[model samples]
Target: MGANIGDNLFSIFNSMTEYMIDAGQRSVLYWDIMRRRGNQYLEHMAKNIPDVLKFDYELLINGRSLPEPVNYGLLKILPPKGVAIDNRKRPFVVIDPRAGHGPGIAGFKADSEIGVALSEGYPCYFIGFTPMPEPNQTIEAVIRGEAHFLAHVNELHPKADGKPVVIGNCQAGWAVMLLAATRPELCGPIIVAGAPLSYWEGVHGQNPMRYTGGMMGGSWMAALLSDLGHGNFDGAWLVQNFEGLNPANTLWKKQYNLYSRIDTEAKRYLEFECWWGDHVFLSAAEIQYIVDNLFLGNKLSGSEIVTSDNISVDLRKISSPIVCFCSKGDDITPPQQALGWILDLYQSVDDIYASNQTIVYCVHEHTGHLGIFVSSNVARKEYFEFASNIDLIDCLPPGLYEAVIEKINYDTVNPDLVTGNYISRFEKRTLDDIHSLGCNTLEDNRCFATVKRLSDVNYGLYRIMVQPMVRAMTTEENAKLMRRLHPLRLGYELLSDHNPMMKPLEWAAKWVSEHRQPVKPDNHFLQWQTLYSDLLATSLNIFRDWRDMMTEQMFFGIYSQDWLQALMGLRASDAPPRKHPGHDPVHLAFIEQRKKEILAGMDKGGPREALIRGFIYVRIPEGACDERGFEMIRRIRAEHHDNHLSEFKKTCREQFFMILLDARRAVEAIPQLLVGREEAGQKFFEIIRKVATAPGPLGKEADMRLAEIKALFIPVRPEQDEK
Candidate 1:
């Protein structure tokens, strides 16, 4: 019995010793990861990485000194391995937000925005900036510079099929919006990913970030910070604010994640940190303008912010198709902020059509703001589908539609054509459909307007009382010191190779790696340790929720009161209704004008024209359009594509608008376009028939349209239908 007891003791002792050895190895591995991360971060920072583009780029235009001088460059991205660009394909211009971080996040990896474009044979261009703005480089100059850059891109890719597809990431989203609005004729389809145009918009209980401008007593502090920086607003402050928004992620979660999976996650962590750590700066005037006009005044959508040349930036001015991509999970630029511009500009769905505009939106169920641009999965799915079917999106009728991307299980789209892994479909949506998603009430508007007014008052007060004192004390050296002392910077510098304290870490880490012992899957202590980490993250998130709840309650409690609102020049019952000018005669004039043009050329079109007209007429009933249907239409069109198709596209687009204006009357005119070309008319009908039958049974509205097409173009013989 004593010998058995001794054996049991020895077994227990061996297990304990193995566990300790594994624990020691893990500790060494962690420090080694940190050491490597520190070295990677230092190297990245030393490189002055701009254009956040991971691929090679040649500088095309320099903003070192010019009339509209800004510290930005227009770069043409060199295609990576296994990818060759076709200039004939639509060119892609990706504009990364210079909010606080440097550019390149959009193109930093092989599976990113630039990557996606390059993979699909599109000539890619990146508009990014140096770390600092040129002397006296205002936002106005920046916008002008960007406009020039795009004009240059258009000039370079003169052979491209359409205008360049401009993608705006975050702050760059608004900049692109300005470009599109100001120079609508220069752009193709616009993709705004996580771009927040309407800054004062948010769900009251959910997105508490909007209340920040109000809670901080307005943008006066921003002005002060800018002045203290000696004319430049450190983008580091912007990065700091982003980090503060998620304490759980910043304080515990991100580091813990790296620590837990240091073996595998080290590279990814270092790569992301390279982007996150290096920040860009905006001129004082630029940041103040952003804060006052956009965040505080909430003026972009209302056409209140004017260009340097006194041109108003009205979204309605843009003629290009716009694709808004947002995420339910993005707290920084929520769906409301990204999409609310539509509400502020157009009062109803018809307004969108009357304005002769097309807006397509796709809301992801769970991607964060950064993920919209950076995540490979998002690139593979959303961006890939978008790049593939851009022409179809461009060809969509003028109105609002929701792009639904679904995973496909079918091996083939047709007998010979293989299906892509995913498919994209646009479903017609109404103004109410968007409203159901969320738009703040007039009362909410009043509160935001009050915040705007208070900002102006506070700005004036700061100008009088604080500006003189700040300007007197501000110096370039102090500004640099403050920037270097920022928490983000301190973390990097402290952990880097330059720090003597981290010297022994390299030697120790190398020794540990050689004698590495890893914890087994069944280790009880390791399992408990993981559980503890989860608890910490959950607890921090819970605290964040509680804190957000309190901030929201305080915001409403203070702003929703009647007497206080009246004191701020708002009436107790002052809730102005947002108007829709769609039904107004002036707005309706465009449709009338289009209808007249269609009627004028009603009898002057060939097989292509007839096909487009008949196809459009058949789709006048909303549910007739499907992704598979569009794809089939595209393939058929490709078989018959010519320079004439461009004119035909315009023709189809005009006719489609006519159908939307008055479907009953538009259908009557279908006979005018198709009656002369009987053989082509029959062919067009067959094409429509194929598309209609593509997605199994025809939808109800589609069935009606199909019957109408058959009535318009009945074949000379029954066998023609078999063809």
Candidate 2:
């Protein structure tokens, strides 16, 4: 009996251990399957993703046969539905960033920037390139080509009222700004969405990406990487760096979310990945110049950069109205980087107005960098409102205005649906508001100066010792192979019969679908899963936050220390003091003359006549209402039976000509016109009331004309205001 009991106990323990081992194996298998299944799902989605977006984009050249001019091309867009063909506005040009992606994000949906413009009866032109730059095409060459493209657009729409509005997104933002600065005459309003200008300015712990250069020893790594690529910098590397910044999203969180709701989320993930996966490349020279000069060295904002022909590129030289669109939640190009340039270049708001520049900015509270340009909701609201109200912005006075778009009830009847009544109120902002965003410390500027010097040394060393070997090893065939074998591309391409594990996944997917037991939307299991996922994401973010803080602290500590500053010959203050250089005498005199002419014209007429003219001018459409307003002036001339009417015509003609000569001048004179006219109208009303009530019988014709004039000057009735 004792022997039997011992044997039974040993058997029971063995069975228990076996069961434990089986459970452990099943858990491991489940996790492994989850990862592979997620990847497989992504691959399937990528392969089957439909091109929901339609663009007339002409492919200029295949990167494989590059070195030559474009062999193929297509127009990126066609006119939208429902607009009459004859009256369509000139095409507006929009260029999307090719930083780590292909194009089409700007016009990817019906509620996109391009789409909004199209809906407004504007022809849309998109500037997009292939996955590679032309073999010998430099950035400067591309800039010249883009300028030529704009000139062509101008020719195509010769009768259009204003110049084409060119919008640049992300990396294209700076490119468009450079174009405007260099050739301001070619475009009208320039919109730069989410572009970084003052690269070195960032909050201490919040923006850690700026400190990456200092943490990695100041662009030496960039030089080495370019050398390794044999005189070309693979933009995929840049894409990887972007992914590294948000590891939770790039690694697990994003994929896990898709898995948890794979039935619905698959399409969205694939749409984004299409652009994200299509990596582009930049020549070593281009990437190096951008890094050493703009990113790490911070030269563009400092007025230290020069073009290839040795021409100075100044931001202040851009004469056209600039619209800066930035978002607070955008980690890539935060509000600081977007608005900091104003503080770097100007001393005060007066400086900006003195230059006759209209700089308007709009800040979205919580959109991410990509969402600023791509989110349909944002595109519908911000972009649609911007396109419709661009003329109002163009006509704003020379100063800073924060553009605010408020939605209106559409049920209310209005005259022109296209010109729906919008309450556009411009709030004044000062240079100090812009400066407080992230104007850098003196120590920050000095450190960047040191970085510029060190970059030159590192680049020279690589060219002399390492570049030649790299060039010899990188042949066209090998480059093609390298592209095909890239992990991101290969991961999708290798999931067919080529992978043995994929065979079982097909069966598993079917089985899982057939026997699927999805958690209820509000089930405790789902709630727990969500809580766990949030915890994981929070942990990853905390790690990233800490890492960034450490990186920034280290950078400031090393570069700001007195001993290190001395060794690097870096100054702790801003550059040597420079005297204030005033404005050009010729331009100042011209502006003063224009201002005087407008003021003089308003002073000539009696209060009632001046008020009538002001109201007429504001309401009438340009050129269209020229006849109507001029007719009213002529009627007053005949009826007054006085030389005042004749004198008013002469002054009106002169002031009108001054405005036609320069739109900027005309807009600047509006406020003074409005103020003077209001005062004159009040005075005229008082005088007319006294005359009418006086004892002498009012001249019948004079009384009638006066009544007619008063009717014209009266403000729109409250009932009419409702319309």
Candidate 3:
């Protein structure tokens, strides 16, 4: 018994000693990681918050020098070694979100949106902003500046196949739509990755972030923050809000991941932190407009936001094909918010058709908001497939569709026709499809409506009661001090060399690294540490869920009261909590005029028209289209015609509408289209046949359509013509 007790004591002592050594080693490595992070932050700041784009770029147009004098600038990304840019191909203009952090999240790495465009031989450009805004610059000015940048890109690549493909990340996504709506001619195909146009949209139980405005009493806090900052809203506040959405990730998992994998995780952690830490500023006017119109009023999708010059912003004005890439895992911009604009703008899928708009949306099941733009996996697959098939999307018939990308399997038909590792196809969708994802009910909308009304009241009260004193007390020096001491920046400041306490840490960390002795994987203490960290994270997650539940309950309870709704000028039967700006008369006239033109040209044109018409007719019955089929058509067009992509798109749209208007007349008129070009008709039918078979055997309906088209293309011999 004595010997056993002695052995137990020795074992306990040995375990304690090993734990201390391991703890000491981990502390040294963790602080070293923090020190490196601080140094990176300092370096990134010293460079004036330059973009994190991995590729080299040359400045093209500086928005500060434009007539609008905004802080945005356009950069032309240079092709890397062994990459050749084809000016004839469409250009890609990637706009990073300037919500809080500095730009370049869109192209933060080599395998990113910009990289995919460059790999596909498209000229790439970036629109990034500086850390500081131009004095008195407004959001409208920013939109105009972006428009000018796009026009310049268009001029630079006059020989390109189509207008520049504008890609917007997060905040930039809505900005892209705004630009496209106002200046429709400048945008080609638009891709909005993790962008939220409908701010109030979310699932009922999840996406607690949407309720934050109500919980905080609305835009008044934002106004107060801007006033306290001396007319500049600190972007760190926005970053903090994002972090607050996931307490487990923000409070424990992130740091613990680094602490546990100190040997291998520092570089990536520092790289991402460099972007996250270097916050930017928004002018007071800008934030006010964003919160008032977008966040509170939920106006952009409804066409309710008008410009200072009295021009209303209408999303229906945009003619480009819009591809929204959102993720189910994104708590920031849920798929509902990313796609809710469709339901807002159109009452039905037919309205989309009437507007002659092509909207394609893709929802990723697992990618987070940042991953939508940053993950190398997403870049290699989604971005690559998107870049390769943009032309296909652009040429699709004007309507709603879901872009479904699936892995190639053994059952895949003609797999060689599909490019890369995945095959991309667009399946028809409707507003019902968006509704199925999840949306706010009438009661939820009424609650938000009340919040908006109360927000305006509170904002006015703050402006009258608090703004003057706050402005009087705030100064540039105080603002700078406040920004420095922000919780987000405090960590970097405290861990940096500037802190005398941390000064000794540099050398000590180096010494410990050289003499490092890592604990074995089977170490009992190490396992216990991991368990403790996980439990902490789990606890935080539970707290977050409970907090979110309380917030939601509070928001709904306060805003959903009948008295509050009545006070806010909203009733059960009055106007909807929000009303969509009905169709513009001029837009209606334009659509009518387009219909007249389509009717006039239904039976016009010769081989080109017949070829495109036949392709549409063959695929229309299937109710789905794939990039493989579109690519085959593009190759056929390239070999047979020299028409520009814009012209081809125009003809395709006209033919599609013609067929939709009168399928029997459209098919019967095909013989007239092939009156003299019978040989070309045969070739076109052959092209359509190849495309139809490339994916697999067509459905019965599609096969019948193809037979009808083939019969139309058959020439009558002189001897048999008498019969």
Measured by lDDT, the strongest candidate is: 3
User: Which 10-residue window in model 2 sums to the lowest lDDT?
Assistant: 620-629
Identify the runs in model 2 with alpha carbons over 4 angstroms from their true place: 1-53, 56-76, 80-88, 409-424, 477-487, 494-500, 503-516, 573-723
TM-score against native, each model: 0.94, 0.74, 0.96
All models: lDDT? Answer: 0.80, 0.63, 0.88
Q: Which digits, one per residue and each the tens of the lDDT, describe model 2 over residues 1-723? A: 999999988876765555444334333334334445446434533542222245434433232343334211224367555643333354678887867666678887777888888878776777766555655456666666677678877877777656788999988898887788788889878999999887877776676777777767666577666555555567777777788788788777977776566656656776665666666677666677778777876666656667888876677778778999999888889888888878777788767765668888988999988899889888777887677666555545466777765544555222122233332334567887777666566666666556555566666776688777776777666666776676766655565445666567656555555654544455444566678888999899888888877877787787667666556665545453221233557867877786666555543434433444433233222111111123333344456653343245334444444443453444344444435455444545544443332222334554554455454444356899899
lDDT of 2 at 213: 72
Pairs of residues clashing in candidate 2: 56-75, 56-76, 57-76, 58-73, 58-74, 607-680
C-alpha displacement of 446 in model 1, angstroms? Answer: 1.7
Candidate ordering by lDDT (highest first): 3, 1, 2
lDDT of 3 by residue, 300-335 (tens): 988998998888889998989999999999999999
Question: Between which residue pairs do clashes occur in model 1?
Answer: 51-104, 52-103, 52-104, 53-104
**Candidate 1 residue runs with Cα over 4 Å from true position:** 1-19, 48-52, 411-419, 575-592, 622-624, 641-645, 715-723
- Native-to-model Cα distance after best TM-score fit, residue 182 in candidate 1, in Å: 0.8
